[model samples]
Target: MSKALTSFLGENLADLKDKGLYNIIDPVEGPNGPIIKIGGRELINLSSNNYLGLATDSRLKEVGKQAIDQYGVGAGAVRTINGTMDVHLKLEETIATFKGTEAAIAYQSGFNCNMAAISAVMDKHDAILSDELNHASIIDGCRLSKAKIIRFNHSDMEDLRKKAKEAKESGLYNKLMVITDGVFSMDGDIAKLPEIVEIAEEFDLITYVDDAHGSGVLGKGAGTVKHFGLSDKVDFQIGTLSKAIGVVGGYVAGKSDLIDWLKVRSRPFLFSTALTPADVVACTRAIELLMESTELHDRLWENGNYLKAGLKALGFDIGVSETPITPCIIGDEKLTQTFSQRLNEEGVYAKSIVFPTVPKGTGRVRNMPTAAHTKDMLDQAISIYEKVGKELGILA
Candidate 1:
């Protein structure tokens, strides 16, 4: 109702549209899976983060519904209050066990977990060396800490070492922390955690890893820290219930004292309503499944390799992805969006990602291969990519 506010939004939205930066969110007609129905059309889904396809698993669905029936749809209050249900404790315990940490604390979402955890531990007197290509939530959380944020080049160990030395030797801040994504979501590259840990140890830097994309896909489903045999060395391991867990929430798994401090001091846990009983229970079961077997994890990597090989054969630059995430790099933003749109028309559903999600002129149609995608589905998607690429002059 405020004219000035309306005018500001109108101008910005028009600017976004003109710059090809406005995102059009699509609605799925059914559950997200290997194949999803969107706007009444069935397409092989390559745009989702449902890495293990647990989002639509029958077992998870059943457990979620059971919780809804027994409890309710909502948590009803913040965690510091009546919202801390028995199921919440169980989910945190499950996270701690899965992450191989002494304790863990859950939050309303992965983004919230970053916001709460960072500010809870670091402040203006601290400095953080963050990955240049970390997720948006990590950037926001670091900003919230009011800490002096320094960005190291993406996956450049030498730069990280130099920065760590500078920050540590400066001795101007009360503490120095280094944070990075366990897996770089855009390029599907695994972080060089081994070297990062080495630098951290050398500089006495506190360590934090946002393992959202690596939770169920790395370290035999434990995570990136475990992937590098640094479970005990990592001070904070952040993860999501929404992605591979196929539920909703986020958490920080760390030392018992850190967990206790987060419970009492994290703003989101203290101010926001907790995760629902259904979400908590479903997440717990997901972790259990991950711990019990590596079937899904193996399948996910298989699918990823299959897709990547096919794309590479067809002359697509997939960047330097070391994981199941595939990006068909299209240097122009509008062309990238057009490539994705044409794929959807041809029965594949990969979305275009451009600046500021990625650097300018490096827009891409990113694909996330899940454990549940059949060979036929992947083959079909690859064929579609070829057809679209040739037609659009992207391939010879």
Candidate 2:
């Protein structure tokens, strides 16, 4: 490697480590359920995005194994080519029905879906009004589109309305669109979609919502757009099969024309290999399960509320999260890292989030309470948290 590249990497890595911002990953020894094994130690796992615990469900696993037996290990080609299998079409149809959209198209992953969908629709001649707290994929997608990106304050409806009106009245762009995450991941706050839709209608701006964290946790498992009753108004509803669905891939659900256009213009769909047969089949089955019953969904919320109440009662700064995603705010970076380390050592695996994942001073240990977590597990986790918080002087 060149000396310049070596120096750059060494300097940046050292800087991150010195500032307590570098992340250390732990490999899970078994299934990433409510309990996980790291380095042969069993811990109450609060770090996974497996909200419904379907990642280890026997039903999903059985179907996936059957699919692999039937369709081999991979799709073997891109969607526009020979990769679009019958199961792929079935998953897309399931997504469309689940999202209440006329049509939908699946992609390799959520990040790729954003990269493909955003750039395929918007261009240098257009403008995109994005929420300030949207996921990094949305940011990269907006950049890839070469559109003028105007960021509004995080969930500040007045700010969004003002920006939308200005962008619309200016007439500098041919098309205008607004995009946001249905639920902000870090803070776990629900987006102001109802007001956003009202403003979009007034300004005639296209609406896009990426409900990666909201699906299977909100809107009765349909997602944030549906939760707000803006299913008919929002132009693009993007979701991940990886998160709540307990599978791997993503999709954009919308009108038939938009799906058709994306099928032709979206580079990822045209160039990248399609999802595996097993993953596609499992994803379709997961959606079917969510549509058929809310048992898992209700349990998820119950655990979430119980955990949040326990933490808040213990004097931890549980932020204003509206969903199952919970964050215990620790203001100092090093202190936050120490808090998480203590939790891990005491048999919990909630990880720390610091800059640049979140702001510098507002570090946190983000907890994800899933449907599979029994009250006994949560109680033990809370006891461990109480002990750690007291030791760390984070609680009185």
Candidate 3:
């Protein structure tokens, strides 16, 4: 490597180290469920996004194993060549049916879906109005689109309307699209999809909702668009097969023509290998389970409410959350990191999110309570929280 390039990287690493911002990766020793084992110690896991606990469900595991038995391990080539297997088509169809859309296309990841879907339609002459606090994937996707990006305040429909009007009034772009996360992961706040739909309709802008965190949590397990009863209004409903689905992949559900266009133009879909047969099968079966019953979703909500109520009763500030995602807002990045370390040391594995991931000094430990967590586990976690809070002088 060149000396200058090496020097620049070294300086950046040194800065991070000096600020105590460089975290060492800690690997989980076993399956990721309501509780996980790390360093041979079990902990009440509040850091995962597996809301429905499908990641450890026996049904999904069985289906995945069967797929492996029948189709082997991997897709041998890119989709455009010969990797589009029967399982892949079934997954796409299942996702479209679940989202109530005409068709769907799958990508290797939710991030890839954003990169593929956004750039496939919008270009330099187009404009995109994105939520100010949308997911990083959405931000990167918007950047890749080469579109004139106009950001609206988080959950502010009026701001979205104003921006949409400005973009349309400019009359310089061929197309205008509005994109947002269906559920804000940090604060666990559900997006104002109904009002966003109204603004999109008023301005005749294309609508997209990335429901990665909402797919198995909202709409009795259908998704955010369905939760708001706007399935037909939103042009693109993007979601992940990871998390609640307990597999891996991302999908975009929309009009048949739009999906067809993506199939042809989305670089990731065309150039990347299709999902493994096992992953596709597991995802399809997970969707089937979701459609068959609302037991998991109901249980997840119950656990979420239980944990949130318990935490609040102990005097810890759980930020504005309308959903199961709860955050213990601990200001100061260093303290937040220290807090997470304390939790882990105390046998609770909640991770701290700091600046760049969140705004400066608003660092927090985000908790994702899932259906698999028992009441006893939650109670224990709350007790641990109380001990930690008092120790840190965050509570009485």
**Per-model TM-score on C-alpha atoms:** 0.98, 0.99, 0.98
- Candidate 1 vs 2: which has more lDDT: 2
Predict model 3's lDDT versus the native: 0.91
Segments in model 1 whose C-alpha atoms lie over 4 Å from true places: 1-3
Q: Per-residue alpha-carbon lDDT of model 2 for 1-396, expressed as tens digits?
A: 999999999999999999999999899998999999999999999999999999998999999999999999999999888999999999999999999999999998999989999999999999999999899999999999999999999999999999988998898999999999999999999999989889999998989999999999899999998888888999999999999899899999999999999999999999999999999999999999999999999999999999999999999998899998999999999999999999999999999999999998999999999999999999999999999999999999
Q: Ten-residue segment with the worst summed lDDT in candidate 2? A: 222-231
lDDT per prediction? 0.93, 0.95, 0.91
For model 3 the local lDDT of residue 43 reads 94
Better of 1 and 2 by TM-score: 2
Q: Candidate 2 versus the native: TM-score?
A: 0.99
What TM-score does candidate 1 reach? 0.98
Better of 2 and 3 by TM-score: 2
- Best candidate per TM-score, number? 2
Per-residue lDDT tens digits of candidate 3, residues 1-396?
A: 999999999999998766657766889998998789998999999988888888999988998899999999998888889999998999899999989999999899999999999999999999999999999999999999899999999999888888899889989999999999999999999999999999888889999999999999999999999999999999999999888887889999999999999999999998888899999999999999999999999999999999999999999899999899999998888888888899899988899888778998898888899999999999988988899989998888
